[model samples]
Target: MAGRQTRGRQRIPIQFIESQDDMYATFSKRRLGLYKKASELSTLCGVDIGLIIFSPTGNPYSFFSPGAEAIMERYRNPDQPVSGIPQFIDDHSRTQLVQLNQALDEVLEMKEQIKDREKQLDEADGIRPKGWWEHVPVESLNANQVLTWTTWFENVRTQIRTRKEELRNGAGTSAAPGSTR
Candidate 1:
């Protein structure tokens, strides 16, 4: 009898697969595995399991060991006292609510931090915390005042550029060896 030889499966790296088709295939296989695990867990423990999945294509897939309605009802009313089997649903709901509240608090703190940063920026610019329109009252400024401010800023910018050019030229000339007057 001739000996039979079998090829072993190749090991792939754990990083992201670049190919879209490969990624989609992996997603499908993993989703199936997840469902299988959920089923096995529910069956072995004799407990209700609800699983909801959203695919990359935005399609939703679900599996409920007992029924969707029963799981959802328990989720909706966490505080409602239940005797047998579905108490896990209430615990999950409470956990979710606590996480949601914590997330909300974090968002509010972020908003306040942003406001503080904005106020700091305004102070750095030597401007009031109020909006530009509110502080300046553009309608109140006559054409002369506007023109004067514009001309002043333009002159200031021109002077700054001129000084920078002069300094660059002076540095270059001074740094050169054997330079005459």
Candidate 2:
């Protein structure tokens, strides 16, 4: 593999693997060894390297030093990219944005569930609690509790709407055609 051709004495091509089956076996072994070396380099020298691999069948694999996706994202854009400092910041910001979006989705789902639960509790107790908001302050909420409340609220709302429809229909009130609710 070291005998692979080079364009210049100083500039060596990092891609050492050939497409031949015998070469492929050597490549696989070397790739693992290379990854180990990369890990050592990052840990010892405090350098970040993003290693990407394409197998013989064209499957993809990767390793990231310290912060995984952040390192790759720093190199994702070439032409419009900044050097070093701001690049790392942008990578961190991008990672944070992804995590924020995931959390937002989870909250939205929880809200739906809370609406359902509120309705059910109202039905079961035959009363809506006065000062419910003051009783359960948002600041004291945990994620799991919020999700549970959301589920109950949504289910109860559905039940109330269904009951209201039943009452309206029984009183000979006609809903507009193709409108179930």
Candidate 3:
């Protein structure tokens, strides 16, 4: 611990960064953190994890536990058969993200068909399109629709972070050191 900080650490108050530069900087750092976290969760649970996030500038990023192709595959088309084992990856973030970027792009693309249907739903029927949370682009959604989608995204992010913390704390308390090879 010679190079480590002498002070203890605590979680900071969460708020949106107002400055564009600061926001971008934080986004880059936190994006890396999300990768670290997903890797940790995959290792801890011995399960494959797939995560996709779009940057403040709309660039997409993904993290997958080697087994994410099936996920990206399924996302490309859920009706398409999913066939693979859940294989946890070590540190393959960069390579895996590059390999799956096309699928990520497809998932992010604005669906013209859905856009027209969403209009009809909002104007006439008033029923939110089911599963829009998955890949519906904001360009097709109204302010209220976007707000609801964002709220759901934030809630999901909070839950993922909370679950990661719980797993970390649980492992820390055990002092098992189970990997002493």
**What ordering of candidates by lDDT runs from best to worst?**
1, 2, 3
Residue runs of model 1 more than 4 Å from their true location after superposition: 1-12, 83-181
* C-alpha TM-score for every candidate: 0.38, 0.32, 0.36
Report the error of model 2 at residue 173, Å: 99
**Tens digit of per-residue lDDT, candidate 2, span 4-64:** 6745535436775565885677668778998889867865575668888997778887877
Model 3 weakest 10-residue run by lDDT: 172-181
* TM-score, structure 1 vs. true: 0.38
The list of candidate 3 runs beyond 4 A from truth reads: 1-11, 73-181
User: Each model's C-alpha lDDT?
Assistant: 0.73, 0.71, 0.67
Name the best candidate (by lDDT).
1
- The true-versus-predicted C-alpha distance at residue 21 of model 1, in Å, is 0.7
